[model samples]
Target: MTVSAWWFLLVGAIVTYGWRAAGVALSGRIDPNSALMRWVACVAYALLAGLIARLIVAPQGALGDTALWMRLSSAGVALLVYFIFRRSIVLGVTAGALWLMAVTTLAGG
Candidate 1:
Protein backbone atom coordinates (compact mmCIF):
# COMPACT_ATOMS: atom_id res chain seq x y z
CA MET A 1 0.00 0.00 0.00
CA THR A 2 0.93 3.63 -0.33
CA VAL A 3 2.39 5.77 2.48
CA SER A 4 -0.96 7.50 2.93
CA ALA A 5 -2.69 4.13 3.31
CA TRP A 6 -0.15 3.04 5.91
CA TRP A 7 -0.58 6.32 7.77
CA PHE A 8 -4.34 5.90 7.82
CA LEU A 9 -4.03 2.32 9.06
CA LEU A 10 -1.63 3.39 11.80
CA VAL A 11 -3.97 6.12 12.94
CA GLY A 12 -6.93 3.74 12.96
CA ALA A 13 -5.01 1.18 14.96
CA ILE A 14 -3.99 3.80 17.51
CA VAL A 15 -7.57 5.00 17.85
CA THR A 16 -8.82 1.45 18.37
CA TYR A 17 -6.12 0.72 20.91
CA GLY A 18 -6.83 3.98 22.67
CA TRP A 19 -10.45 3.03 23.17
CA ARG A 20 -9.41 -0.37 24.51
CA ALA A 21 -6.92 1.24 26.89
CA ALA A 22 -9.57 3.72 28.04
CA GLY A 23 -11.93 0.86 28.70
CA VAL A 24 -9.27 -1.01 30.64
CA ALA A 25 -8.52 2.05 32.73
CA LEU A 26 -12.20 2.55 33.51
CA SER A 27 -12.93 -1.13 33.98
CA GLY A 28 -11.26 -1.15 37.36
CA ARG A 29 -13.76 1.46 38.62
CA ILE A 30 -16.79 -0.52 37.45
CA ASP A 31 -18.33 -3.52 39.15
CA PRO A 32 -18.27 -6.77 37.22
CA ASN A 33 -21.79 -7.59 38.38
CA SER A 34 -23.21 -4.17 37.57
CA ALA A 35 -26.45 -3.89 35.59
CA LEU A 36 -24.65 -2.10 32.77
CA MET A 37 -22.20 -4.95 32.46
CA ARG A 38 -24.98 -7.50 32.44
CA TRP A 39 -26.80 -5.58 29.74
CA VAL A 40 -23.64 -5.37 27.65
CA ALA A 41 -23.14 -9.11 27.92
CA CYS A 42 -26.73 -9.77 26.87
CA VAL A 43 -26.44 -7.43 23.93
CA ALA A 44 -23.24 -9.07 22.79
CA TYR A 45 -24.80 -12.50 22.93
CA ALA A 46 -27.85 -11.30 21.01
CA LEU A 47 -25.66 -9.84 18.30
CA LEU A 48 -23.71 -13.08 17.96
CA ALA A 49 -26.90 -15.12 17.78
CA GLY A 50 -28.25 -12.77 15.14
CA LEU A 51 -25.09 -13.08 13.08
CA ILE A 52 -25.13 -16.89 13.26
CA ALA A 53 -28.79 -17.05 12.30
CA ARG A 54 -28.20 -14.75 9.35
CA LEU A 55 -25.29 -16.87 8.14
CA ILE A 56 -27.35 -20.06 8.28
CA VAL A 57 -30.37 -18.49 6.60
CA ALA A 58 -28.65 -16.18 4.11
CA PRO A 59 -24.91 -16.72 4.03
CA GLN A 60 -22.67 -14.48 1.91
CA GLY A 61 -19.75 -16.65 0.75
CA ALA A 62 -19.15 -20.40 0.34
CA LEU A 63 -21.64 -21.14 3.09
CA GLY A 64 -24.27 -19.40 0.96
CA ASP A 65 -24.11 -22.27 -1.55
CA THR A 66 -25.33 -24.85 0.94
CA ALA A 67 -29.03 -25.62 1.34
CA LEU A 68 -30.84 -23.92 4.20
CA TRP A 69 -32.32 -27.20 5.40
CA MET A 70 -28.88 -28.74 5.44
CA ARG A 71 -27.52 -25.96 7.60
CA LEU A 72 -30.45 -26.07 9.98
CA SER A 73 -30.32 -29.85 10.19
CA SER A 74 -26.65 -29.79 11.03
CA ALA A 75 -27.21 -27.17 13.72
CA GLY A 76 -30.02 -29.21 15.20
CA VAL A 77 -27.90 -32.31 15.28
CA ALA A 78 -25.05 -30.38 16.85
CA LEU A 79 -27.26 -29.07 19.64
CA LEU A 80 -28.53 -32.58 20.26
CA VAL A 81 -25.04 -34.00 20.39
CA TYR A 82 -23.84 -31.26 22.68
CA PHE A 83 -26.64 -31.86 25.16
CA ILE A 84 -26.26 -35.61 25.05
CA PHE A 85 -22.52 -35.45 25.64
CA ARG A 86 -22.45 -33.08 28.61
CA ARG A 87 -22.11 -29.84 26.64
CA SER A 88 -18.85 -30.38 24.77
CA ILE A 89 -18.78 -27.26 22.62
CA VAL A 90 -15.86 -28.41 20.51
CA LEU A 91 -17.49 -31.71 19.67
CA GLY A 92 -20.76 -29.95 18.95
CA VAL A 93 -19.19 -27.48 16.48
CA THR A 94 -17.06 -30.17 14.86
CA ALA A 95 -20.06 -32.45 14.39
CA GLY A 96 -22.13 -29.58 13.08
CA ALA A 97 -19.58 -28.45 10.50
CA LEU A 98 -18.92 -32.04 9.43
CA TRP A 99 -22.60 -32.79 9.11
CA LEU A 100 -23.16 -29.72 6.99
CA MET A 101 -20.24 -30.64 4.75
CA ALA A 102 -21.33 -34.27 4.36
CA VAL A 103 -24.98 -33.60 3.62
CA THR A 104 -24.18 -30.74 1.30
CA THR A 105 -21.74 -32.95 -0.60
CA LEU A 106 -24.12 -35.90 -0.69
CA ALA A 107 -26.92 -33.73 -1.94
CA GLY A 108 -24.73 -32.59 -4.87
CA GLY A 109 -25.29 -28.93 -4.26
Candidate 2:
Protein backbone atom coordinates (compact mmCIF):
# COMPACT_ATOMS: atom_id res chain seq x y z
CA MET A 1 0.00 0.00 0.00
CA THR A 2 1.02 3.61 -0.45
CA VAL A 3 2.41 5.71 2.40
CA SER A 4 -0.87 7.59 2.74
CA ALA A 5 -2.81 4.34 2.90
CA TRP A 6 -0.47 3.02 5.58
CA TRP A 7 -0.80 6.24 7.52
CA PHE A 8 -4.58 6.03 7.38
CA LEU A 9 -4.55 2.43 8.49
CA LEU A 10 -2.27 3.26 11.37
CA VAL A 11 -4.33 6.24 12.40
CA GLY A 12 -7.57 4.32 12.19
CA ALA A 13 -6.16 1.50 14.24
CA ILE A 14 -4.89 3.90 16.90
CA VAL A 15 -8.19 5.76 17.15
CA THR A 16 -10.28 2.60 17.24
CA TYR A 17 -8.09 1.05 19.87
CA GLY A 18 -8.03 4.28 21.85
CA TRP A 19 -11.82 4.47 21.96
CA ARG A 20 -12.02 0.84 23.02
CA ALA A 21 -9.51 1.47 25.78
CA ALA A 22 -11.39 4.52 26.93
CA GLY A 23 -14.67 2.62 26.99
CA VAL A 24 -13.11 -0.12 29.03
CA ALA A 25 -11.59 2.35 31.45
CA LEU A 26 -14.91 4.12 31.88
CA SER A 27 -17.02 0.98 32.08
CA GLY A 28 -16.17 0.34 35.73
CA ARG A 29 -17.10 3.86 36.77
CA ILE A 30 -20.25 4.09 34.65
CA ASP A 31 -23.44 2.21 35.42
CA PRO A 32 -24.72 0.48 32.30
CA ASN A 33 -28.37 1.04 33.38
CA SER A 34 -27.90 4.65 34.38
CA ALA A 35 -29.65 7.54 32.60
CA LEU A 36 -26.35 8.87 31.28
CA MET A 37 -25.46 5.52 29.79
CA ARG A 38 -28.91 5.22 28.25
CA TRP A 39 -28.56 8.67 26.72
CA VAL A 40 -25.19 7.75 25.30
CA ALA A 41 -26.62 4.57 23.83
CA CYS A 42 -29.43 6.53 22.22
CA VAL A 43 -26.98 9.01 20.76
CA ALA A 44 -24.86 6.18 19.39
CA TYR A 45 -27.85 4.57 17.75
CA ALA A 46 -28.96 7.90 16.28
CA LEU A 47 -25.50 8.47 14.86
CA LEU A 48 -25.51 5.04 13.32
CA ALA A 49 -28.94 5.62 11.80
CA GLY A 50 -27.84 8.95 10.42
CA LEU A 51 -24.80 7.38 8.82
CA ILE A 52 -26.92 4.62 7.25
CA ALA A 53 -29.38 7.20 5.95
CA ARG A 54 -26.55 9.24 4.46
CA LEU A 55 -25.16 6.16 2.77
CA ILE A 56 -28.52 5.28 1.29
CA VAL A 57 -29.17 8.83 0.06
CA ALA A 58 -25.63 9.45 -1.20
CA PRO A 59 -23.43 6.40 -1.18
CA GLN A 60 -19.81 6.05 -2.28
CA GLY A 61 -17.92 3.39 -4.26
CA ALA A 62 -19.78 0.19 -5.23
CA LEU A 63 -22.94 1.02 -3.26
CA GLY A 64 -23.20 4.22 -5.28
CA ASP A 65 -23.80 2.11 -8.38
CA THR A 66 -27.10 0.80 -6.99
CA ALA A 67 -30.26 2.77 -7.75
CA LEU A 68 -31.92 4.70 -4.94
CA TRP A 69 -35.08 2.65 -5.20
CA MET A 70 -33.17 -0.60 -4.82
CA ARG A 71 -31.36 0.69 -1.76
CA LEU A 72 -34.52 2.03 -0.18
CA SER A 73 -36.40 -1.15 -0.97
CA SER A 74 -33.68 -3.23 0.60
CA ALA A 75 -33.74 -1.08 3.73
CA GLY A 76 -37.50 -1.38 3.91
CA VAL A 77 -37.38 -5.14 3.53
CA ALA A 78 -34.61 -5.35 6.07
CA LEU A 79 -36.64 -3.37 8.56
CA LEU A 80 -39.66 -5.55 7.90
CA VAL A 81 -37.67 -8.72 8.34
CA TYR A 82 -36.09 -7.38 11.49
CA PHE A 83 -39.46 -6.58 13.09
CA ILE A 84 -41.04 -9.77 11.78
CA PHE A 85 -38.23 -11.86 13.17
CA ARG A 86 -38.34 -9.96 16.48
CA ARG A 87 -35.20 -8.04 15.62
CA SER A 88 -33.06 -10.90 14.42
CA ILE A 89 -29.87 -9.42 13.02
CA VAL A 90 -28.99 -12.45 10.89
CA LEU A 91 -32.38 -12.63 9.21
CA GLY A 92 -32.57 -8.90 8.62
CA VAL A 93 -29.11 -8.80 7.05
CA THR A 94 -29.83 -11.87 4.94
CA ALA A 95 -33.12 -10.47 3.75
CA GLY A 96 -31.58 -7.15 2.80
CA ALA A 97 -28.63 -8.73 1.03
CA LEU A 98 -30.80 -11.22 -0.82
CA TRP A 99 -33.26 -8.52 -1.82
CA LEU A 100 -30.46 -6.35 -3.18
CA MET A 101 -28.97 -9.27 -5.09
CA ALA A 102 -32.34 -10.19 -6.53
CA VAL A 103 -33.04 -6.64 -7.60
CA THR A 104 -29.60 -6.24 -9.15
CA THR A 105 -29.94 -9.58 -10.93
CA LEU A 106 -33.33 -8.65 -12.32
CA ALA A 107 -31.93 -5.31 -13.44
CA GLY A 108 -29.25 -7.18 -15.41
CA GLY A 109 -26.30 -5.19 -14.13
Q: Give the distance in Å from residue 52's predicted Cα in candidate 2 to where it truly belongs.
A: 1.6
Question: How would you encode candidate 1's per-residue C-alpha lDDT over 1-102 as one tens digit per residue?
Answer: 447788898999999899789889988797978999899899989999999899878989888877789989999989998998899999899899899889
Instruction: Please list all clashing residue pairs in model 1, or write none if there are none.
Output: none
Worst 10 residues of 1 by lDDT: 1-10
In model 2, pairs of residues that clash are none
Off by over 4 Å in 1: 1-19
- Per-residue CA lDDT of model 2 for 4-107, tens digit only, reads 78889899999989989988999878778999879989999999999988998889999898899999999899999999999999999899999999998999
TM-scores for every predicted model: 0.74, 0.72
TM-score of 1: 0.74
- lDDT of all the models against the reference? 0.89, 0.92
For each predicted model, how many residue pairs clash, with residues at least 3 apart or on different chains? 0, 0
> Pairing residues by index, what is the TM-score of model 2?
0.72
